[model samples]
Target chain A: MAWVWFHRFGSPPHFYRLATRLTPWFAWPAALLCLAGLIGGLVLAPPDYQQGDGFRIIYVHAPAAWLSLMVYVVMATSAAVGLIWRMTVAYAVSASCAVIGASFTALALATGMLWGRPMWGTYWEWDPRLTSELLLLFLYLGYLGLRNSIDDVGRADRASAVLAIVGVVNVPIIHYSVIWWNSLHQAPSVMKFGRPTMPAAMLVPLLLMLAGFTAYFVALLLIRARGELLRRERNAHWTAEAAGATATG
Target chain B: MSEQRVGFAAAAAALIARDLRLALRRSGDTLQPLGFFLVVTALFPLALDPQLSLLRDIAPAALWVGALLSSLLALDLLFREDAQDGTLEQLALCGLPFQGLLLAKTAVHWLLTGLPLVLIAPLAATALGAPYEAMPGILAAVLLGTLALSLIGAVGAGLTMSLKRNGSLLALLVLPLAAPVLIFGARATALAIAGEPLAAPLYLLAAFTVLSATLAPWALAAAVRIGLE
Candidate 1:
């Protein structure tokens, strides 16, 4: 029974149909939660004693930052699964992940910069976390570039998988090295997400935003993965049947 | 058992010797990275203040970056020539462990490019106004750093071997991964120049080098297999 379920999950046609079915389930909740979280965070939560109204940026920035890291781990994990099991669906998921991951990484960096300008009096600093995030963006670009440059789908899948795996392994190493180098240079300290406590007003919305963003990512991933599957399995009979059904209905 | 060990060593030695001979025949290719390194170091002083104090301050970073970029110069060619000429395929199909062959090729890269970089780092360091005391530390750091670079570069080279024009793509794939080496390498050089204790950075570098040495061959071998597929 388990083996049968596994095969169904790995099958591209089945996965494509399932993804299409499930996307709305994620998308509607994502919209509702994000709306509620925004209102709760921006309107209901009291301004910070220190940062005041500016602290609300964390609602967007922290979730973007969280998604950036989370997406890469998901990307790398799917890439590994694709490589190990030779599953087309897993490769599709991995391929769909890069652009989204890169976008959130950019969002995180942009929002962090916006927050930094007034808070740190500069748009940029080589703070360790920021530096590592910048490097993570580069890694995503590298993965995407490698994928696009390779013309063959299977070849590209395996090649980019190798890179994604390598990048994942090095992410922590790069993070620590930046920290160590920053300490050695003894630059002015930048703010960290190491706040000791947050009141319920602030914390609740942030948690909701995080969950909302995750659902949003799933919705987007499922839609993108369905497209990837269609392209990869264009010749398969299910695609033609699915296309015909959609065209007729 | 002893004879099998000897045979394995002999096979690796032969592989290294063959690559060295090929590199020597293309002596211009062998010399290009070193020349590029020297020119890059020279550009810093030309562009920046010629003041010795200022140059000394930026010397560690400048030299480290120079070495890092120069090492990249030779990397794209690491597997391309053999891969194009069918040598890489032949070695893969030869029934001996492909991982060992990958390691040998990486060793050859270090010997031709990395070792010379380590030897000439002092000249580059001195040109940048780094003090005499920093030479030993600079050499040690470059030696470890470049070996790690070669190992890391092999994975990149293997991954990109199938692509016809992979120069910039290869760097893109490798640079972020090489960040730790640059950080630790530059820090050690700074410590050496400042006459401060340099043990921590050096240990960290050594640890990174050892880690890469252990795992890179497996990754390189896997990448080569996928490239060929």
Candidate 2:
């Protein structure tokens, strides 16, 4: 009985039914959290003493950077699951992950460039973090490219899985490359190994924003997965039956 | 080749020699990448300040980047010709494991494409006015690194060999995956010439090559098998 959840989740029909039931639960809370976080972030979070109003960009930028990595890890894990379990649902979850992660990475880069214009006095820097972030975007693109270039769905999943697993090694390398070398980027601050660099006043909003961003990503990922699953499972009778049930329900 | 008579080394060498002869026959294919190498490197001096010191400064990265871009220029040939002519089917039918076949392909690539790049690199290094001390490191890094690239690229090429429009698609797939090699090789050359510790970057490059050599062929063979399926 306890393992039934896994058995249910593993079935396409069961997963679709589960997704349908879970959608609004994720959707409403994610929306509410995002709206509240946005308002609280914009109005309540204190301005950085150094950068003033410009540092407001952190409310969005930090979360995007965080999601950029979070999505990659999720995708890689899903890919790992797909490889080990030979599960098509796992592949769909990862495929959806690529779309969402690439968007987050692009947003992070764009927001960083905007932040740079005001804070760093330049739109671009050959800085380590910036360069590595840019590379992350390329890695995502390469993953998608590997998928599209292969016509067979199974082979595409396996090939891109290999690419994702290999590319994750770059994530730590990208993070530490700055600290390890002479990168123009700043060293790790509040997120350092020790205690938070900033007091709770600042930390609270950042934490809230992280929660908001993660919920938002979960909501988006589920929707995207549902769509991809539908497409991939179209020829299967489970999809037809699920569609019939949804129509009646 | 009986079980007791034929060893792995002998088999690998024979396969490597076979591929080398094939590549040597219509070796105009080899010259394409060499030309691309020269022309792309030609752009760097034109685009950047060609002051002798400046050229010397960026020479390592430019060399590594040029090699990367050019090595990939001919990567589609890694399995395309064989797959198209039914030779891949024959090779697959051969008793030799795909890993051995993949290793042989990389060796022949080193001889045909990568070897010429090494020969021409001294000329390019001089033309760019890189310090004399950097020359040995540059050549060594490119040679080792490009061998690794050929091996990795073969995996991608084998996967896409049967797909239509493999040429451009091959570049798209292989180049991004090969980024670390370019970065590591270029940095290794630069640091060594600057009287820095050669051990670290050299070890990293070697690890990358060793890992790629050990792992990429099995993946390539799996990819080829999947493609055939």
Candidate 2, residues B1-229: lDDT per residue as tens digits? 6556556677788877777777778778768989888887777899898898888777777888889888887777777777778777776776767678666776777777788998998778777776677777777777778887888788777767777755466666676667667767877777756756666666777877887788787777767766665
Clashing pairs in 2: none
RMSD to the true structure for each prediction, in A, is 2.5, 3.5
Candidate 1, residue B182: Cα displacement in angstroms equals 0.9
Instruction: Give the local distance difference test score of model 2.
Output: 0.75
Interface DockQ of candidate 2: 0.37
Clashing residue pairs in candidate 1, if any? Answer: none
Model 1 spans > 4 angstroms off: A187-190, A245-249, B1-6
lDDT of 1 by residue, A1-249 (tens): 769988999998889889989999999999999999999999999998888898899999999999999999999999999999999999999999999999999999999999998889999988887899999999998998899889998889998888888888899899989988888677756565636688888888998999999999999999999888888896898997756556554
The interface root-mean-square deviation of each model, in the order shown, is: 0.8, 2.9
Second chain only: TM-score per model? 0.95, 0.89
Q: Each prediction's DockQ?
A: 0.82, 0.37
What is the CAPRI rating of model 2's predicted complex? acceptable
Best by lDDT: 1
For candidate 2, state the interface root-mean-square deviation in angstroms to 1 decimal. 2.9
